[model samples]
Target chain A: MMTADERGEIEELLPWHAAGTLDRREAQRVEAALAEDAELARRYQLVREELVHTTHLNETLGAPSVRALEALFAKIDAEPQRRPGTAPGIAMRIGEFFASLSPRALAWSACAAALAILLQAAVIGSILIKEKAPGSYETASVPTSPGTEGTDVLMRFQPQATVSDINRFLETNKLSIARGPSAGGIYRVHVSGAKLSKDEATRVLNTLQQNRIVGFVAITH
Target chain B: MQTNSDEVLIGRIAKGDRLAMQVLYGRHHVQVYRFVLRMVRNETTAEDLISDVFLDVWRQAGKFEGRAAVSTWLLSIARFKALSALRRKPEEELDEDAVGAIEDHADDPEVALAKKDKGAALRTCLSKLSVEHREIVDLVYYHEKSVEEVAKIVGIPEATVKTRMFYARKKLSELLKEQGIDRGWP
Candidate 1:
């Protein structure tokens, strides 16, 4: 008589054996046991039935609607693309490089970075005050700065445009990303240096709209 | 793209290749959707969860170390997302239409027995299984995953996977017996 534990062991392997996922040894064992045990053979038959039923059940569940893929792609388009070479390795290497610096050198570097930030902040504050001065005609634009109060423009890049194409376009236009690619793939690009007058801003917007790389551009007010 | 191995596709996806993402999604999205649908029992939620699952795949493709088959990896992610979704909305009920459909087949023991289509009866019983038991059955039988693969996807020990599979089958047998279709073993 097959021991209870042995029967149980073979019983568990029966499903895998029916599914044909068992390795040779386990398959052989289960087959050998099936030959000897009528009860085990009956259980194996039931496993086969369950396997068939389960397969049919899942097959009937069907595929998700195409809308699922459309939504997925839209989310993907909105997500900021991680550049090819900017894997964790780059961050780790930078970490190692900083770790290798002498304590004194690191402290001096930190101090220099703090001083630079303070100087940039002072310049930005002065520019903001100047923009808001007594007789200045206030523009409806949201004040964002790349070291100075500047007009933020909302622009959508062409889907086919590569990151390099975007970087080159931004450089050529002297615009910096202040925020976004929001859910709509619109970026808030800051025109650096002086804020533009309404006509100059409209002219810049018209120019951006004409570029093949830009699909839409609007002066954010 | 169709011929590229899943690992190769994942490598390309890690580099922000949208075409590769589309290919991988095409290859596996149905299975992932079905798996999540089985767990959540709602089509809309399953559709939403699948989007989240593939989005994770797109974002974390670089983290896939090829220790598991791509299908297994996808199911693992799907399982995690489904379970998290279930937890967040714990009171969410089974899809009434699905339950009604299955019940129509097996709810009346006499009707089930009269139909004499053991396959339909078996399927209705399979649907009646607890989430844990149903998942084990589906992964092993429908997905044809190995014990190790099921363990990895379900995050359980291989031994537990076997026992769970055994119990799931046993429970299924008991369910069949309730429908007056005994297969003669405990």
Candidate 2:
């Protein structure tokens, strides 16, 4: 009968020996046993072979097709951008949903602007020739700066101008403008007036063919 | 096809060459991915973590001391990331859909998809080994680090390293035999 320590040592040696984990001394001892004993070497080979074959099977299972990797990458790209403790907000979700919205809205807006410019030219002709004012109107705009969105503009009706009048006011003063959000909210004008002199503000003020209290200056011109 | 060596690729990536990054990613992503998947067992999480690994490489390639093989350093990064990901959200679910996607990838496009599969087989087999024995085989055979290096990595005697190697290969061979895989190369 083997002593407890000897039995434990052999047992400890078995897995490593079978798998070839033993260092030279331990390996030599195991090998010497194998040299004197066929059974030990056979057992070692058996264990090693099983490990090899099983690993091979795993390799087969883990093999993914190229289409699969691309699909995986594409899937990763499509995963929702989420943070650790919070769900994504609605506004962003909406933008993501509408990410592919066509330039149709922009084109239509441009057409409307061009038409208004034409109509405004006609109105200006009438006013210049007839020397008379038309009915009441109001003016406002939505913004489209390539930066973080600011407070949304709500529709405001000034008693002195139409969309054409606002457009004219902006054009004459070199101020950009927003008509309105098609979804919701009012039209507003955007004037990049940082460092704008009081003289420049006064020029824009006088050029206002429509009504709007110029809000805060966003950046210094 | 012949590819640039890992060190050269790493140097280029460190220098902020986007093309070099693309090449390096192409070469190592799958291997690193396989290693991560094995450690974490969650394919989607594993996939996500590998990106962090690559990003670190891109950011820190300049800091690499050239002390270890690119593979070893990469595996080390992967190991750290997988552990942290697991620690942060111990319950992070393996996205079944993402895993399915990975399965599909392993099946089709990656020309080396076959190699990753083989690596998976090796990983599963390695998992069956004791942790001590596992590291040795992983560092030497799969990651292909040398014995002296492996000894230094595991902080054990060289003799202990050889003994562990003897047993690791022996057991691996036996396991392969039982599974009807060829145990020894012909």
Candidate 3:
């Protein structure tokens, strides 16, 4: 038998267990208890067996020895027909919302959406196209200097970070705007060119990293 | 009265037969209502919950995945409606007298023996369990939802369902034992 605490737990479990709601751990404990204890098990079975015959609503249905089915259907008919979606007018109105969108607007939206998507895709695609070197540099857009002397770092900006702010940092550090749009969502400045001084790239990358938009940065040779 | 098979009626429901809705509601509503009634332990709330279950079935009948038995799916809906009703309250609970009433309501022999035997005792003792415990068993057995479906419907993790069923069956075992019924069957 379950202790007061155990029984209390068991008591709480009985409803769902009877209703079939117990979580696996609690259920396992209940089962083990039943398996070990005969009285609890017996009570469990008796309740399980009795669940079907209960009729609470039949209090209304019982006495009429007359057409119970008709009475039930009568009740059904009397119910507030909350069948909103089933009505022809309502369903047609919803259908019209789908129908009202002319093919022209949809096609136009699709093309515009696709074009914008492709642009976003291209920016990311170009960035990822290079073979990444572990803790090393792989520049997608060559700097005017074309020298690997400047440290390469990768940075990601926060949502609120603006491309202009990123561009300002790039300009200050002599980092050339690489594959990313200096005008778009994120400005990825590659300070690979000759103008970029030794350790200047790292310092600039670190500065950008502190910026709210620039959430992360990685440095490479 | 012996009811029509859930499988046949369900197929008709899928075909958009309105009468199938009526038949399905007429046949299963009582059990579904009883299940909700036991969990919520209120007559009017149980009725509303029953209607909610049928309304869902009516709207989503075509969406039935047929992954499990129709009765199982119906029970899953019933369990969900009941739980939603249960959650709507601030610290809502089933009172002892209300629960006792459920047990007493089920024990009426005329009602139990209607199809009798295994089904009746299941109802009576089911009321004896706590609202939380009874809810799971009602969904599992009376509604016939599988553990995964029950878990999803109840919005708990899946493992919780097995545990609920374990304790539920233990309770059922005790109830059945009183009637000399052995659930020794697989």
Using DockQ as the measure, which candidate wins? 1
Give me the runs in candidate 2 sitting further than 4 Å from their true place: A1-40, A61-221, B1-4, B91-141, B147-186
Q: Over 4 Å off in model 3, which ranges?
A: A1-221, B1-16, B90-128, B139-159, B167-186
Top lDDT: which candidate number? 1
**TM-score of each candidate?**
0.63, 0.39, 0.37
List DockQ, one per candidate, in order: 0.31, 0.03, 0.10
Q: Tens-digit lDDT track for model 3 on B11-63?
A: 45555566977778776666666666666766666666666676666556555
Per-candidate clashes come to 0, 88, 59
Q: Could you list the chain B TM-scores for each candidate?
A: 0.89, 0.60, 0.60
What digit string (tens of lDDT, one per residue) describes model 3 on residues A164-221? 7666766675766554433434444565545455567567666766654465666544
Question: On residues A67-139, what C-alpha lDDT tens digit does candidate 1 reach at each position?
Answer: 9999999999999968757442343346547978999999999999999999999999999999889898765
* Candidate scoring better on DockQ of 2 and 3: 3
- Candidate ranking under lDDT, highest first, comes to 1, 3, 2
Q: Candidate 2 chain A — worst ten consecutive residues by lDDT sum?
A: A212-221
RMSD of each: 25.0, 28.9, 16.4
* DockQ comparison, 1 vs 2, better candidate: 1
